[model samples]
Structures are given as C-alpha cells and as structure tokens.
Target: MTVSDQENLLHTSSYYAASANDKSMRSELIGEQSCDVCIVGAGFTGISTALHLAEQGLSVIVVEGSRIGFGASGRNGGQLVNSYSRDIDFIKHHYGDVVGEQMAAMAFEGQRIIRERVATYQIDCDLKEGAIFAACNNKQFNELKEKKALWEAHGHDQLTLLSASSIQEHIGTGRYAGGLLDHWGGHVHPLNLVLGEAKAFESLGGVIYEASEVTKVTEGEVCQVTTAKGVVSAKQVVVAGNAYLTGILPDVEKKAMPCGTQVIATEPLTPEQQQAILPSDHCVEDCNYLLDYYRLSGDGRLIYGGGTTYGAREPDRVESLIVPKMLKTFPALQGVKIDYAWTGNFLLTLRRLPQVGRIGKNLYYAQGYSGHGVTSTHLMGKVLADALQGDTERFDVFAGLPQYPFPGGRMLRVPYTAVGAAYYAFRDKLGI
Candidate 1:
C-alpha cells in the first residue's frame, strides 16, 4: 500500500482510544499567543515537558500539528523498558566510569518518575509491573547474562537472570534460550499516559492547542513560532517534535531520520488461552537488532509489534507480516484473529543516544530516543525543565554526546537509511 494508505489503515485501529479516560478535544491555535516556553509536538516529549514547566510555575504553551498523543508516544508497544539502544559498556568506553555510572543511575530514574507521577496525579493508564528481555539464541543469552552482571555491578539490583526453564515458566515460550527480568520496567496505555499528563498540565494553568501546524520558526531575542492560524512568541522554544518534526527546524531534521514501526493486536483470547500464552502478563522483547516487542493487554488482547519499514510508507500487509512472527513465539495462536493494526514513526540518531541540547542561548531541542522514549522522554522533560530553571548539570551530560547528521539530504535520506537498515536486517537474520 501507499504511505498515506498505510497510515490510514494503521491509525484507525487504536485500542487506546476506545478505552482512554480523557477524550476531551483541545482547541487549536488560532490567534496570537505568547508564553515563557513554546513547545512543538504534543507527544510524550512535548506534553511531559509542558507538564514539568507548569509544575515549576512557568508559563507554557504547547502547539501540536495534530491531536495530542497522535505520534509514536500514543501508538508505541507501551513497553517501559530501561536502557537505550547502546549498552552500558558503550557508555563506559566512551565517557569513563564516573559519568557512565551517573548515566546508568539516571536511566532507571525514568521508571521511578513515571510511577511517581501516575500515583501523584492518580492517572489510570493500566500500569503493570515486570518486563523480560528474551534471548533468541545462545549468543544473545550470554549477552543478557553479561548485562545482568554489569547492571548489578553498577548498583542496579532489580534485574534477575532467568534460565531457559525459568524463562518458559514466565513467558510460556520455548523459543528463548534465556532472559532477564526487570521489575521496574513494565507497560502502560501510552495514549492515556500522554493525555493524563496533558490534563495535569492544563490544571496547572498551561495552554495546549492542537491542529496547530507550526509552519515557520523565526529565532530572535524571543523565538517566534508561526502556525497556520496562530503565532506564539516565547522567551524559550523547545522542538520536541521527534521524527514527525519537519519544516520547524532544519538542523534537528538533519540530525535524525524517521523510521516506521508497526504493531497489531489480536482479538481477546479466552481465559484458558491467555493463561497458556503469557501467565505473568509481562512485556517481552527479543534481543535481535530488529527486535520483536509484545505484551498482553489489560483486556486480554495479545499486542505484538515487529517489522520496520525504513521508508515513510508502511508494509501493505502489516498484520500478515507481524502475525507470523507472533505465531512463531506462540504457535498455539495459529487461528487467532487480528483485531487491530497500526504504525508510527520513531526517530533514530547515528549515535543511538537521545539528543538533548540548546540551539541558542534560550532555544532548546530534545529528540532521537531510538525506540526507548516512553520512560526516557519523561526523564528528559524533567531535565529540560531543570535546565530552563538554571540546573544544566544533567542535561549537559546528554548534550555532551556526539551525533552525526544523516548522510543524504531530505530527498535521498529514506533510500540511504533503507540501505543501512538492510545491512542490520541481514545481520539479525544471520544471528551475527
């Protein structure tokens, strides 16, 4: 199918919308506006930052091109797994033990912040505990074991190493050789989390305007963001648009590329079938470079996610591609029906680290979480807010990392990324 057709096919099947607690429609930006901070993109990064700023008693205005939670933040697999694409060894090798330890400690803090906010705000997002990193081969199993040791050495005691038998006991899948369980990392309804945070921000006297496509961003003493129907001039501007961020900032667009990931949810399983498939109700992700992440929803639906498209378009048969992978993990679900399918874009940077830094003296931007945005984005929001309030220590650590621009310009970026991803896909297939 074409890109537009794929987007339409996928977006129409959001389980979160049917069960979302907050369904109120926010007003679009239609007039002149000004605030202390003007945020672009209303996904987790934007909403979380706005909420943090509002809590600090700062005037904040968020302008979203589409509705809130319409981006990856709303459509992800909802796995709140810790750690980024790069491993702890990578950080230690590049940034020394002291900084690396600090970064590792900060990584787990994201999960803590999410749990605290959920309770403090009383947001109902179907929060759950436990996440498993299942290994597809012995090599990956050894890697997980090494990671468990490393995490323990770094003062993280929440991770438990599970042997093959123990892994089967938890996931009911014999395909994995072994796994690691993180009690702190779990799942939640992503849309509800974003919307709940948006409500909390509004309650704190923050302004949010949807359908406000930012067309022009002119930087000056006070950066001006121009939407089709409104304009926002603020002392500070934050470009939290991630992959969907286009035209607002060319420099950020150059540093990261958008890749599409798809997901499908099966019809509710019988209690017997659900118990057979996943007894513990924990999120599961394999250790492949092109990985498969899945979880059983609160309503007993099997939410499976896999198969990425490097280009803008999604696959013609997303359900067909992903269902086979899901069935491989649980062959008993041979005749299960797929009830929903969707796709969303995620931002990836060359460094595989989140890019957080200031554009000018007052203008800042944060994006490129590389598929670990759910928890990291929330932590980033706090860091960004603290920076705006003159606490730059934590934010500077992330900004100190290096990032490479996409080799080709916008016209050739998709094709270039396709070539690069093809290499990784081949490697994953070979288990290299």
Candidate 2:
C-alpha cells in the first residue's frame, strides 16, 4: 500500500487492534477546553506523561488524532528491550563519555517503569519476563560478548551469553550462532498495556479525547492548541505524536522521518508447537540492522514482525513481506497459516536516539525513538513530567545531546535513510 493509504488509517487491521480490551470509544473534543497541560497524542508517551503529571496534581488533557495506542505504541513488536536504539558504545563513541555514562545509568529505567506500572495498575497485558538477542553470524556473536562486558561495566549483571549449543536450550531454532539473554528484557500485549495506562491516567483524573486531531499550535506562555472542532488553552503543551505527528509541528517534522514496519500473527500453535519454537517463553530479536523480532502471544500464536520500508509506505500485504522471513527462521512452519498481518510507522532520527526538547518556552516535545519507543517512551514520559515540574536535570541529559536534522532535511531524509539502511543490511548479509 502507499504512504497515503497508511496515513489515512485510524488503526491497522492487526491482531492487537482486533484483540484490544477497551471496546468503548472515547468522546471527541467538540468545544473549547482548558487544562494545565494539553498533550497532542494519546499513545504511550502522552498517556504515561499524563499519568505522571496528574499524580503531581496537574490537570491534564490528552488529545489523540485517533484512538489511544493507535500508533506505534500499540502496534510495535512487543519486546521490552532496554536502552537507546544506539547502544552505550555508540553513545560514547559519538557523544563522549560523560553523556554516555549518564545514558548507561538510566538505560534500564524504562523497563522498571513498565514493570511498576503493570503491577501498580494491575494491567493484564500478558506481561512476561526475559528476552533473547539471537546472533546470526560469528561477528554478531562476538559483538554480543563485548556488549555484555560493556553492560556489566555499567552495572548490568543480569545478562548472559549463550554458546551455539546452549542457544538451543532457550530457542528451538538452529538459525542463531548464539544468543544474549536479558533477564530484565521481556514482552507484553502492547495495545492492552497502553489502554490500561490510559485507564490509569483517567483514574488519576486525567482527561482524554479521541479523534481530536490537532490542526494548529499557537505558542505563548499559555499555549493554544486547536483541533478540528475545539481549541485547548493550557499552561503547557506537549507534542507526543511520534510517527503520527504529521505536519502539526514544523520544527519537530524536520528532526525525524517516519518509516513503515510490517508484522504477522500466525494461527495459534499447539502447546507442543509452542514448546518447539520458543521453549523458554522468551521474546527473541536478531542482531542485524534489519532484524526480526518475534514472541508468543498469551494464546500461543507466534507474533512475528520485521521488515522496514524507509519511506513509510505500507507493504502490498504484510503477510507477503514478513511470512517468508518467518519461514526462514523456522522452516518447520512453512505451511502454517497467518491469522493476521499489518503495517505501522515509527519515527527514525538521523542519530537513532530519541529527541526530547521544547518547541517554544511552554511547549515540550518528545519523538524520534527510532524503534526503541517500547522502553524509551516510558522513561521519557517521566523525564518530561519532571521537567514540567521545574526539575530539568534528567531532561537536560537528552536535550543537551545535539539535535541534527536529517542531512537533507525532511524531504530527502527518507531516501537517504533507505540507502544507509541498505548498506548496513548488505553488511549484515555479508557477515562483515
């Protein structure tokens, strides 16, 4: 499908949307509204930030263009991998040791935030523990060994490197040279998790309006955000739309490019089949730039996802794009029927690190998580909330990092990223 086709969707026809728990539709913004904070988007970043701010006694109003979790937050591969998309070594090499150390110390905070919310809110998103990074080549295997040591130096001790033979104990496939097991990394039912967080935010007196697409923003001490049918005047404004941000904020649009990703869900496997695939019940993602990530759902379906179209165009059919890759990893399931398939977009920055800063004095924004929104968004929600309350220490850690607009700016970033990705993918294929 074309980018225009995907852009017009309220939500993908994916397994998560089909199985979503909140069947009730939220009210839309129909008239003038006012609040302490007016957030534009009800995905994880918006919902989590609202929950945190409301807990701090701020009146919060969240406005989503579509439904809550209707973007990448709900549609992503549910793996809860910690740290930035660019790892610590990359951070240190590019940004230097001071910023890298700060990033490392806070790398695992997002996972902790997720676990705490799941338990505290009693969210039943099929939360599970443990995730594996499968290495397809010896070079990737050696990098995993080095990564473990680097993580250990940063005080992460729950990582274990498995040899090729030992990898079979965790994963039932022989496609991996070895794997890195992260006890803290895991998976969850992403849509349900975000929906539950929205409910939690509501319980804290936070307000949310679905289908209230923000069309314009007038920045001032009290920012005014206008939707199609209503206007929101607030003490502060937050633009958390990520890939779905569209052109609502021009400054933000320049810093990141949206890219499409595809996923497929197989028919529920038998208990025996489940054991034969992921025996340890751990989510798995490979070590390539263009990587495959898969995990078993609560009902035993293989929730497999991968493939990226740099220009954010949907695949003609999700199954056609991802099923062959799934079959390659587990050829035993060659004939297994795919139950559902869908495509979603994620914001990719040139640096691959999430961008968090202000559009103006009273307006705060966070996006460009690359594919690491699962963890980074939650961590950022807290930081954004804290910064709103006059504590910018943690927030500065991110805002201080240089923000480089895509080399050719918004119009050309997509093709530029596509070319860069093709190069890395080729290197991965060549096992260099």
The numbered model that scores best in lDDT is: 2
Model 2 lDDT tens row, 1-432: 457534543567888988888867789899999999999999989998999999888999999888899889989999999889999999999989999999998898999999999999999899999999999999999999998999889988999899999999988889999989999999999999999999999999989998777899889988999987999999999899999897787877888889999999999999998999899999999999999999999889999999899868877888888999999988888889899998889999989999989867889999999999989999999999999989988899999888889888867888888899999999999999
What is candidate 2's CA lDDT for residue 72? 93
Q: What is the lDDT of residue 35 in candidate 1?
A: 93
Per-residue lDDT of 190-226 in model 1, one digit per residue for the tens?
9999988888889999998876778988778999999
Please identify model 2 stretches exceeding 4 Å from their true place: 1-10
Judge candidate 1 against the unseen true structure and give its global Cα lDDT, from 0 to 1.
Answer: 0.86
Decoy 1 TM-score against native: 0.95
